[model samples]
Each structure stands twice: as structure tokens, then as C-alpha cells.
Target: MRALLEAAGVPMAVARSGLWRPIHPAHVLGIERALRQWGQSMAALGAVAAVRYPERAAVIDENGTTSYGELDRRVERIAAGLHADHKIVAGSKVAILCRNHRGFLEATLAASRVGAEVLFVNTEFAPPQLAAVLERHAPDLLVHDAEFAVPAGIPAVPSDLAALVASDASAAPKPESPGHITILTSGTTGTPKGAPRVPTAMGLAGLMASALGRCGLRSGDPMVIAPPLFHGLGLLTSMMAFFLGSPLVLARKFDAEAVLDQVEEHRVGVIVAVPVMLRRLLEVGPRDLPSLRVVLSGASALGASLASEFIERFGPVLCDAYGSSEVGIATIASSADLIAAPGTVGRPCLGSSVRILDDDGRPVPVGETGRIFVSSGLVFGGYSDGSSKAVVDRRMSTGDMGHLDQAGRLFIDGREDDMIVSGGENVYPVEVEECLARHPAVAEAAVVGVPDEDFGQRLVGYVVLRSPATPDELIAHVRGELARYKTPREIVVVDEFPRNATGKVLRTKFGS
Candidate 1:
């Protein structure tokens, strides 16, 4: 399949052509060796950070902060406890079910120390859903976060079982061991896939380094993480802070007031938020948060008008980035680009290649709508079923539809899965929804492709109006802004649309 994909004729999107500098052969080998060496155990990476910056705070949980030295000690002790108490060792996958607490970090590090991969189960996953994930992954050890205690034989991380591992004095695993992370993808469509987290983490750090350069992140940057620790964005952000020897202040869940308080209290320099969160923050945040140097918004299409509003309110420090779980970091719109382009997801980041491809997997013209494909520096180690071809594909149609402008900036059309084909025309719901939300009366809107006999699939707009906007008025208003064919066929004015815990619209549950 990969060979077939490689043999296909594809022209590079003008935006992607000549955008990246090839890594030196020697440097590539050196980095590969380093990644391999660190793969034996994630603890080696933690050890390097601990030794390099022992006094630096590693994590700032609700209780207090733990320095890198303390974090290392905890990992060593907990890892020993894991092995001695639970008899878990190399090749064991440990399921960690916890909220944004310190135990998550310590348990992950402990599992890594013993060459065990950590399976991060979303705390929000209901009992059956959680059970399904556990059964699928088949973790040898289960670390619940104290609150959830129903699953028999699943030991809590800080329980007596873990205390036993802490009692042991065994050394951490050597480098060159088997891969040590099995993270479940967000799984918006089907079941979540277990993706290797190591490659994802490395790729994210590399991308962050390339885009922000050395000046952005520092030793004590209190990363204000608002996204739940379960999601890829949250988990990877926390891991990057840990890997870089910086302190993370997790919000457990996003709350505008709480986030603002933390930013001021911790003097947080950086924050990673989605586009929606940024809007919410700006709506409720204090007039000034002087310590915040960078505010990163990603995981969804960023709107130009929204970006301008944010900059006008919060000052020019917003960085718009684009990437996914399968392929790590792809493109970044720097602070300058956020001001200049406003809504662009930015040019492809260093060590990555991107192209806009049409339905036939051929690159579209400079300013044409097509599926976005990314060849990234850090691709997943393939799916859990052990298929590396997709991970190594020179170009992967990201299943996202978008177009590139003549200036090489990418504008998202919408997810191919979410695109509504109405009367033989592709109608991107995001574009229409964004247009609807801009109205004076509408506060929030979600556009979904619904089953329709005539059009194959019709666009349905679910809106949360701040004031009052009838369905007819909204439908007419959208028609004026968008192409008549692209306008939503139906507008449903409701208090709210069903959203996941992360606030992403759950279009699948429209009828139900």
C-alpha cells in the first residue's frame, strides 16, 4: 500500500514546495540514535532532565510543586514499587485512569522506568467505554486515580500496590528497550486507536523548537494547560513541559476565571488553548496578563476575525499551530503570522511537508480546495496492529479539506468526514458556521452534515443564539454570506449543540 502511494504522481502544493531545509545526514542519524536510546525507557529522558535541572520545578499540582529531582525520585521509587509490588516489568502496558493530578505524571514515569507503556484512558470515558479500552489494550497493570475503584485487580497508582514498587531499589531500564508508550487517539469516528506516544512527543518538541526557537520556552515556564489531561493536546503539552524541565500547572478543566487566576499567580509564560478556549478566555479574562508571552491555539480551524479580536483584546502573542495525533506537528502561524494572516494555520513547520490534494490524491492548484496531506518529521510508530506504512507515507491525505493561498498560507475547508455534499456541491460546515457565529445574535454554532435523500447529505446548522434569531432569518443570512449551494439547508436554533468534554461539536449525536 505504501509503495503504491509512493508511486503515485503528485505535485507539491506551492505552499509546501521548498519550505523546509533537509536535515544533514549525520544529524539525522544522531537524532535517530538519540530517540532509539531513549526508547528503551522514557525514564532515560526524565533522568537527563532531572540531572540537568534538578532544582527546577517539574510539576505544580494542586497540592504543591515537585522539582525535577523530586519527580525523578518519585518515578524511581514508584517504578520499583510497580515491579516489586505488581510484578509488572518490561513489555507491560499500564492503564492510568486519572484526572489532571500528579499521580498521572508519576505513574507514567514509573511505568516508563520499568519499560512499561502507559495507556492514558480518558477519565470521562464511561465504565463500559473504559472497560472496552482496557480490554483492547490489555494492560498488564491498571493504575486508577483513587476515585475510580470498581475494576477489580486494577491497582491505584499511589496505593499499597505502588508503595511496594517504591520500596524496591532496582535500576531503571536500559536504553534500546521496546517502545514505551501506547496513547489512544481521540477516536472521533470509531474506537480510539493506540498510538505510540514517544514519537509523537519527540515530534511535538522538535516542532515547538523549530517554530518558537530557543527564546520562547525556558526552565521555569509555568505551562498553563487548560485542556483535559486525557486528550492528545493536553497530554503532549504536559509531557513537553516535563521533557524540557519546565513546570506545568494543569487546570483539570478549562475555567476562564481559574485560568486567569493561575496565569497571574504562577506568572505563567505560555498557554496552549484551542480556538474556542481563546475566545472564551478573551471574553472573561482580565484586561492584562503581563507574564504571558505566548498563547498557542490549535486542534481546530482558527478564524481570522476571531484572531484579530483576540489580538486586539490580549495583545499580539497568539500563535496559531496545526497538527494531529497520527502525524505530529505540521504547520505553525507564528505570532507575527497570527497578526498578519490572522486565521491561517500558518506555513508548514520545519521538518515537515504539506500539500493540498484533491479527492483523487492529486495536488490542487495554488488556491484550490483539497484534502491536506502532511509528511511530518515525527509520525506515529504506526497503528497498534503494527502497520508502519501509513506512518511512513511520504504524504498522508489528512482527511482534512483545505486550500492554500498564493502567499502559501493554508485555509481549512473542513474535515472530509464532516463535509456536506449538498446537490453535488461540497459545503464546508465550518465556513458556514463561522459565518453564522459572526452574526450579532448568534453566540455559538455547529454545522453538521445530516442524512438527506435528495442531496445525499444536507448541511444542518445547530446554533446557540445569544439574543434571538429565527431559523428562517439565520438560513437567509447565511445564504447571503455563502454561496447559495453552500448555505445550510436547515438551521436549528437551540440553546446548545452536544459537545464532547473538550467542547468539540459531536455531530454524530444530532438525531439522538
Candidate 2:
């Protein structure tokens, strides 16, 4: 453990902060009972929070606030209700398809308490995609919000916040084994795959230490989570809040202005969101949000222009985290690093090993691009379909192409599959996209390869413009900054780009 901590670059003082603080005898007893009931899983994190900060607010959602003590009791009753009425016993797979709110947490905790594996369904899934996921997972029970339409033949229960908390049953079900959490990958390239994982004590501790040291976040600080909880960034932040006894403020939907309002209302110190959310928040223009100390951006690339603009307008609160669903968090770049390194994704987090590997799985030299592989305790073992990512020397491939600088900062070039071979020259769309984004008129851009009789493959750029800019002008701008072959063959200016729930541009949806 000491070596792992040191490898992660975590200071010894931060490592000591992972130790348990003194608590009252009564709280200790409650924690012990929770430990015996839920084992060392995420459920136990919630249990410890409830005992340590019973009077503090655990969650603040659209419905109102829930104290930690109240949340604990509600989870117990919901667990009992699921067991008594739904027959959700140990090993049962409970698929939850709700937005961010108290009910989502309630259903998750309740399901885990009974040793049932929890699958967090993406709320933005299309009907066919949702149906296919349901068919594939074959969950025993589905707990969902009233707003969504559930597929026929699944035993589903309503997840209304009021109704769930008003249940009469107060007894918690004891799980036979620790429940596992399954987070689905964002299907930007293809069908989303499930990454199932069981949390270990050492893994959780390392994650906590790295997050604390990188983000400068302390336990018990109020936090606002703006991304979907089903995603890796949101889920990890929520788990950290529970473990640290921090109050989590959630919203059913993400509205940029409303997020600012909530931060001011709750005096939140940390704001967790994806890069698109940060862009939207900045679009709302500058305002007084003094309580916000850290802005954690993840789930997608944070382009250099966007990061600089955000930090300039909102102070040095922006922190970019680079990772994926398969591997938890690998690197975190602070505001200074964002400005100094520009497009760099910062250094590896504590207890994480990141390497750029060539085709033969050999390490690439610094400043050379290759497949990004990471070895971390928080990485998932495999997908639910019994398939796993390629592992070399205990390191798992992140499916991203990147390189490290002489300063040890990591910079993502693009997705390995997104590389385009045009006119016998290799081009990464991210480089072109970044060049286009630096233009004053461009708001967002996506580049994809299309079939061409002459070149075999050609680059086509789709852009959403904030102001007026001709296609020819944008193409010329890219040509000026990058190689002629790397420049888009054609540029199309559009009002908007097709994006997923988390605001990732759907390159597959780009029209020919």
C-alpha cells in the first residue's frame, strides 16, 4: 500500500488523511453494523457517512434535502421493501434507469444492501438501444423514474422520490455477498458495453487519496455534480462524497444557469461535470459564484481553447481529469497545468501507471504517440459479456492514442479508431478539431473519415459555429495551422452537432 501510494505521487500527509477519524461510540457501533451488513462495498461508504454525519445533509435534490440519518433509514426501508415485495434476493440483478436524484441513490443503496448487482442504465438510450440493453442484461428487476417508458415484460417498480421514502418497512436486508456496480461505456463508437466491478478497500483508498491531492477537496464540503450519475466521473465523485461525508446536490436535468444558482444556494465548494457542461456554463456568461473552488471536468476531451477560456473567466478553479469507463481515473490536470501545458491531460494519478505503447506492446519514447495503456487498482476487470480489454504487462488499453511530454504531462491525440488515412498521410481528427476550435467563430467541431475514390479515405469536418464563418474560410484556417493532408477536405457549418447525453459529439452520426 505504501509503495502504491508513493507511485501515485500522493504525499505521505495525504495518505495519512485516508485514516479513520475519531468518532463517538454510538456512531462506531452503527458503522460496525453497516460494515457487517454491506461488507466493504459502496453501500458501506454510505453507511459510514450516515453514522459520522447523521445530522448533516446527505443529498439535496429537486424534492428537497435529505439528512444522512434520514437517507440511511430510507435506504433500509427500501431494501426491506424490495426484498418483501419484489423478491430481490442475493445475486439478483437490479437495473436502475433513473436520472440524478434521491431516488437513484435510494434504489442503488437498497439494491446493494440485498447483495444484488446494480446496473446503471443510461437515461439517454434510444428505445431500440434500451430494449437491446435490457435484453442483454436480463435484470431481475427494473427500478426507474416515472418519466421513462419501460420495456414490456420487465418487473419494474416506480422510483418516485416521495413514494420511495414513504415506505413503511424499516428493516435492512442483509446481503450474502458484496454487490458489484456495472457502468456502461458511452457508445460513441458502437453499442455500449457494461464494465462490472467490485470495489476493494485498497482501490477505494487510493482513489480517494488521489482525488483529494489533485482536486484540493476536503471531506464534508458541499459538492454539486452536474453530469449523469451513470457516467464514470459523476459516479466516482458521488462515491467520494459518500465516503467523505460531503453533501451532494443533484439535479434532474442540467441547465447551465441553474447549476450556478444551486452552487450559490448550497455554498458548494466543488463542481463535477463534463467538458460540455463547462462550456455551457461559460456561455451563460460570467457571474458571481464565489463558493465554487474546484471544477472537475471529465468524460471527454477538454480542448485547449475551451480550458483556457473557462479558467480565464472563472478563475483557477478548473481541473481536467482524463480517464474512461474501463479504467476509473488515470490523470488529473490542475488549472496551472492546463495553462502551462495547453492540451496536456496532466500526469498520472496516485497509484496509476500510464504508458504509451506501440503495436507490438512495447513502450513508446516520450513525445511519441501510441496506444494509451493504464494499470490502476480502480480499473475494471472485464465487461459483463465476458470479454475484456487487451492487457499487456498488467496494463489495460484505454483505446486512446496519446503521448507524454518531457515534463511527464499526458496529451490525448485522438481515439485510436478515429485516426484517418487520407492521401497516404495519417491524420488525427482531434488535431484538426482543436485547430478549428481555436477559430473565434467555431463553437464545436467534429471530424470523420469518409470514403473517397481518389484518396481511399477523406476527412470531412462538421462544425457548430458561434458566429458567422464560411466553410472555405474554416478549411483555409485549418490548412494554415496543420498539414494540408490533415486539413478537412470539406467543411460544413451547422447550427448544432449530434451529441450524446454527456455532450460527446457522435461522429458516427455525421452525414456523408
Candidate 3:
């Protein structure tokens, strides 16, 4: 508890400037009034942080820096505009469809302030997908970037948020409740569903405690969030930044060299990214990054070769977070954990539990693969459609197959549905994918099963190479690493794999 509080700058100086001073009486009163009106939403966090660190930079985006005081005022003004102009009152649903920038934060915080349920729409969604999601969710207002077109029947305002914040409007007062924040599932296997979770103080603290302690994040450290704010990993880390009074550096797109530039420019202490972003950073080759202390990876699998290579090049600053949209962050792997056991997702977080259960819900033996179940306090009640995951003894299934090491570290084998039976052998594509990734010529690999006449299924490997290599030579590399049946029957070279917004490969695009 103490560590978590300290990391949040409870008694420490504000981030970047390290300014420590007593909270003025007026500031304290303002904070209390704001919280009384807005409750525990992001608006409250911004207001309270403003009272404590009024002059500190709360956000640094393309529009430039916004102090805590300015951020609080902007959020409140935007909320007032939505309330008065758009008639978005308590219980109204507001869908946000912007990339990582000040607009995304402004819209989200504003909607929450007015007690409106905020649905974060993925920016990478195709036009049809976006239209379908908006239609199904039926949000009252659609807050989107300028690049996106507003669907019919939904009231919307583009990313020119500055105008809205400055527009003539009545001040919005307190509401009956703090509205829920809904994050749509990644929808890798199916259509995305709304997963709404009302933020609770205890749930937020538990996640922060585990991440801060395991990843070496601390007070007054600047952070750059490279992933989209819609993902759980990005959302949670952004929340961590607000509470810690850290200056959040954001960009609408993830560019490897540009991210490194921001780290050096802002003296960033932590970077939150997905594994594919990490791979791009490695490809760019970091130089003179003295202020970069932690690189947090999540939202996708971090292959063993990638983890080891990142750690080797970056000198043990990589931490892998594990969880999903259904269940919030359940585990955090520290640098040491990654060093000792590459690809391990660390251990269960504080106030969280992990269980390896068989089909009938019996506990599996240590080091044995089985279904992965996690119980994080932040798990949503149910999807927006009223469908929920199967919960066995309070732990919800993560839909993954994994094993735990003797040291209690968890390693994901693959998605339970992704397992393939080839020649009467159960094979995990991730194992072969990892082996292929280790080859000097291979940059990354994705393996999928195809129906075969002889074997039940056959493995087909698609690889993006760092250097030129023939299929025969790559097949030999995998043969040297694993059994013959485990190797992919055919290797296909690709320029790049189609990726979802959060950087996971869209295997369905590969004709799987």
C-alpha cells in the first residue's frame, strides 16, 4: 500500500519538475468541490492533481502541453458543452473514436464527468465495423477524430475539441453517479463486444501496486504511452500516469523513431507499448536513451526470442503485463523474471489469483499445460449483450492455454482454440513460431493450421524476414529446434502481417 501510494506521488514531488509544496486552502477546497460533483471519475483525478500540482504538465500531445489546472478546466468545459449542447446527461452513452492524443483523453474525461457511459471505439476499425459497433451500442454522441466520418443518427463533434471547450455553454454540475467506462473486446476471433467496468478505488490500487512495484515505475517520472488508449494495457497505464501526476506524452500514431525522440525530449522514465511496437523500436535501434527506465509490453504475446533479444539490447528494462479485456491486468513480469524465464508473464498481481485448471476445473500439476484462469477485481460484469464468460470457482477463463514454472511464473503456450492436431500430435503454433523467430534471417513469424487429407491438420508458416532466406533453409532451422511434425510444412514469405489496432496479428486475414 505504501509503495503504491509513494509511486502515485502521495507525499512525493510532482512528475518532471519535482516541485513539492503545501496545497493551498483554496486549491484544497476546489479539489473537494470538484470531487463532490464529479465523484471518482478521471475528471476527479485531474481536478485533485491540479490542486496538488497546478503548474505541472499533465499531458503533452500534438496540441502541446496542458498543465494540470488547464486539463481540469478543459475537461469540465467539455463536459459542460456536452451536457448543454448535446443533451448528454447522466446515463447517456458517449462513444469515443479517436487515436492516442489530447482529444481522446478530453472526450473520455468529459463524458465521464457528466456521468455518461464512455465507449472507446477502436481507431483501426474498418468503416463497416465502426458503423456496426455504433449502431449496436447506440451511443447518444460520437466523439471522433477529424479523419472519421460521423454515422447517421448519432450526434457527433469532431477532434477540433478546442473550439468545443471554448464554446459558450452552461457549467455542468454534479450527477447522480460516476458513469461506467466500457472497453470493447479486441475481437480477434469474433465481433467486438462492449465490456463495461466502473472504476473502483480498490481495483485501481491493486493493479497499480503490482505494476509499479514489478516494473520500477515511480513518482515524478515522465511517461510516453505508445499504444492506443482503448486497450486495457494503455488505459490502465494512462490512469496510472494521472494518479501519479506524471506528464503523459501521447501521439496519434506509433512511430519508432518519433517515440525515441519523445523519450529523449521529455526525459521519459517509462514507455507503455504492445509487443509489435517493441519490435519496431528494436528495429530502429535506440541510442542515448538514458532516461528510459522501463518499457512495458502487453496486449499480445511477447515471443521468447523477442523478449530475450529486447532484454539483451535494452539491458533488462522490459516488463511484460498479462491479461485481457474480459479480465483486467492479472500479472506483471519484472525485468528479473523476464531474464530468468524468458516469455514468462510473471505471477498473479496483488488481490488477484491465477489457476491452471483442466476441462473439469481440476487444478493442473505444476509445469503442466492447461486452461488459464484469472480473477482480477476489475473484471467486467458481462458484455453489453448480456453474455458473460464461464467462471469456475470465481476465476474467469482467459481462453488461453499455459503452464506455470516451479517458480510460479506463468508462460502462455497459445490460445486454446489455436492448438492443432497434426499427425496425431498436439502442436502449439507459438512454440514453432518462437523457434522460427530465433533464426537470424527471420524478423517475425506467424503459424496457422490448414486442413490436410493425410494428417488431421498441417502447419503453414508465414514469416517476415530481416534478411533473405529460402523456405528449405528456414524449414531446416525449425527442424533443428523441434520435432519434425512440429515444423511447418511450407514457409511463405510476407512483407508484413495484417495487424489489429493493438498490434496483434489478424490471422483470419491470412486465410486461416
Candidate 4:
């Protein structure tokens, strides 16, 4: 598959950047040796980076910068410690619950090095929720931050980078095969489900090519990852940085001004964050962050108003990606595409196919809203509990309702389950929310359907305001932009919206 893609000019995307730089004979031998020792997991990728760019900065955290050489040595020792002290071995499940930083990367790479299945646990999980996850997965070991309280009866390891590095154990023996990576869903609707991933060589290559082409990320550039490492968007970008030998500038906690400070201080080139982070950065006021070339937003809806407002303030650096844990990054919209087609999520990535299908499993016409289905190598096989999304024509449903323009750009209307029926009229809350967001006073808005006696289900909006605006005025504002039926019946003004770790609004928590 890599050969086929390379033959068809897909390789040009990665090759144009120095990612395809020729490996020295010694470095090639080192990579080969490391791959044999660590399998083909993230550990091998880190080892290759260390051999090729030993002196290059691999991670910049609160403790300061750590070069690739130092990171590699630390990872080896950590892997050795986990194996020697904790008996973490091949097929062992290693749950990682930590914020974004060098420790998160260190724990992840070290676990992979020891051939353990890495389960990225959400840092925002409540104690009960965390216990439930641990009980279900029953991981062999849990590596977490010092700040977090672990569940009872789980063998745990601290995610302290210095402590792990200080260990003097030798490296663990190579496993028979590479281990898996499980990323849990945001669980906004209910209990979080694990989406396990084992990337094939072809799939990784295709995804890398697509991301590099669309995101304009080059090798060796410093990148600021502001999102939580446990989330898909953050994890993917961090892995991409490791793959490209790019220095990752990480913040333990996301502060909008701190992100800008990091970008300015490190002369960073790429910024990986979710939509909420982007909004926060904009709220921090404008600064001359000229070094930043790409601001990648994902993990939630990027409304037209927010996209336009961000681009207006930061130039054409915003790139919105649309995907979920079930499906890896399926679509990406560049700054120009966002400006041209406000709600578009851009075209299908390279080597991936997308189709909009109606309820009957038939393709919908261009500009007609339907279920979004994607077929890509990056898509996960199934949930950890043996459940799988329905597949049509070998394409898995993204569980999103969207339409494609004549030019093939995708526009997400809302989630399939988010649709509300009121008085014989179908309404997608996203439309109403987007309309509300356009209002000057509204900072963020979320709409959910409530049981109604007359209307069957009525729309109720919860909004966080940037300026003063009455409920009547906000309702009138939505009425002006959309049909009367699409307008929220009630607009509740709030100081802030309840958000998950990745900044996605928890609609379930609203009005409760």
C-alpha cells in the first residue's frame, strides 16, 4: 500500500518536507536494531528519532528541554524499571492517566517499549468513572500523575519523569509483536467506551502523508500541543512530532496566555489544540506569534463564526479537523476552506473515502444532509467491549449528520442522535447553536432537546455570554437567523458552559 501511494505522488507530501531525509548507514542499523528490540510501536519511533537526531530537542516541559538522546535513554530505563519492578511485560495492559507533558510521553513510550497495551485514560474522569474504567480494562499497571488519586486495588506507578529516569535497570527484552493503543471516547452522552487501535504500516504512512500535506507541518520544527494528551487530536499530533523528529513544547495545564508565551518563547511552528482552546487563545488578546504557522483545531465543532473570528484575529492559520475516537482524523479544513465554506470540514484525506448516506444506506445527493461514513485505514477495528459501528460498503459510520458540497467539501450538520423533532419539524441543535454563536453577546452556546407537552420535544439553549444580552434578545437573535421552529424555545444565560477535558460541552450536564 505504501508503494502504491508512493507511486501515485502521495509520497511527495512527506518527501517535500525533510521527513524522508536519507538515513545514515549507522542510523539505519540503529533503527533496525531498535525496531527488533521494541517491535514497531511508538518506542521504535522514538528510538529512530534518537538515532537520527540525537542532539535535537525532543521535549520541552516545565522542567526544561530534553534532547532526543536524553529522552531515548530515559525511556529505556523507564521501560526497564516497569519490567523489572512491576513485571510489566508483553501483552500487559498499562493504563496512563496524566496531563500533557514530558511525563505523559515518557510513560507512553516506555510502556510501548515493554510491549504493553497502552490505554490512555481521560484525566477528567470522576472517581467512580475512573474506577469503572479500571475495573473493566483490568490493566496490569496504572501510571498516573502525582496530583491524581488512584482507584483502590490497582497496582500503580507515578508518572514522575525524574523518578522514572533515575532507575538503573536494564532495558526489557523485545516482545513477539507490537502492542495496541486504546483511546477512550469523551463519554459526554454516557459511559466512555475504549477505541483500540493498532496501526498497520500502510495506515501510518497514509495518515502521515495526509496530515503533513494538509497541516503543513515540517520536520524539526517546535510544536506546542495545548490539548490533553489522552485525547485523539493531541495524541496524534504528539505522535506525528515524534515521527518527524519535531520538538514538542508541552504545558502541564492549558493557559491561553501560556500557550502564546510558549509559542513566542520557543519560536514554535505548529499549535495543536481543540476548538475551545483556540477560543481561549483568542480571548487572551492578540500577540505577534509570527512563528506559528498552523493552529490545528479538533475534538469539537468549529462553528463558522468561531472559525472566522479566529482567522480574522490570527490570520489564516486555523485548520479544523473533524473526527472522533471511533474514526481517526477523517477530514481537515484549511483556513481558506473555512473562509470559503464556513462550516466545511474540508475534503476526505488521502487514501481515505467518505460518503454521505441516507437512512436506507444509499448515497445522498450533493448538498443533501445524511449520515457521514468514512473508509480509511486509520479507522479503528471496533470498541474494546466487542461492539462495532455499523459498516456500509466497507465504510464505518462516523455517527455524524452532514452533507457534501458540489466541490466535495463536507459540512457537518450535527450528530445523528442530536437531531430533535418538534411539532412535526426536524431540527438540528447545531444550526440553532451556530445561529446563537453568531450573536455578538454570545461567547459559546449549546442546545438540547427537552420533553415538551405540546411540541413533543422543545429546544432549550444554554449560552455563556461575553457581553450582556437578555434571554428575549438572544431568542430574537436566533429567530432572525433561522426559522422560528429552529429557534430555541428558551435561552438560559450562564457564566460558563460545562466542558469535558477536551473542552467539548457536556450537554448532558446542562439544565440538570
Highest TM-score scorer: 4
Weakest lDDT window of 10 consecutive positions for candidate 4: 184-193
CA lDDT of 137 in candidate 3? 92
Would you list the clashing residue pairs of candidate 4? none
Q: Of the candidates numbered 1 and 2, which has the greater lDDT value?
A: 2
After TM-score superposition, what is the CA distance of residue 121 in candidate 4 from its true location, in Å?
0.9
Q: Name the lDDT of candidate 4.
A: 0.82
**Would you list the C-alpha lDDT of every candidate in the order shown?**
0.67, 0.81, 0.81, 0.82
Q: What's the CA RMSD for each of the models?
A: 12.0, 10.2, 10.5, 10.0
lDDT of 4 by residue, 246-290 (tens): 999988888889889888999999998866677678788779987
> Model 1, residue 356: what's the lDDT?
83
Decide which is better by TM-score, 1 or 4. 4
Question: In model 4, how large is the Cα lDDT of residue 437?
Answer: 90
For candidate 1, report its TM-score: 0.72
* Candidate 2 C-alpha lDDT tens digits along 42-87: 7787888888889989999988998999998888878888887778
Candidate 3 per-residue lDDT over residues 1-512, each given as its tens digit: 23344555443322222433455799769877877887777667766777777788988999899987788788878988999888999999999988888888889888888899999987766565678789999999998898987877878888667667985788776789889899986343345688898876667766776666677676668899987898788888898888777889999988989999999899999999877677778888658889988999887777677788888888889999888788988888998998889879999887788999999999999999999999877877888888888789999988789999999999987676776655433467787888889999999999998866435468999999999899999998888656566789999999999999999998768863
Which residue pairs show collisions in model 1? 40-177, 77-166, 80-165, 81-164, 81-165, 81-166, 82-165
Candidate 2: misplaced stretches above 4 Å? 1-21, 161-172, 186-189, 419-512
- What are the clashing pairs of model 2? 8-350, 8-351
* Superposition TM-score, candidate 2 onto the true structure: 0.80
The TM-score that candidate 3 achieves is: 0.79
Q: Rank the candidates by TM-score, best first.
A: 4, 2, 3, 1
lDDT of 1 at 247: 80
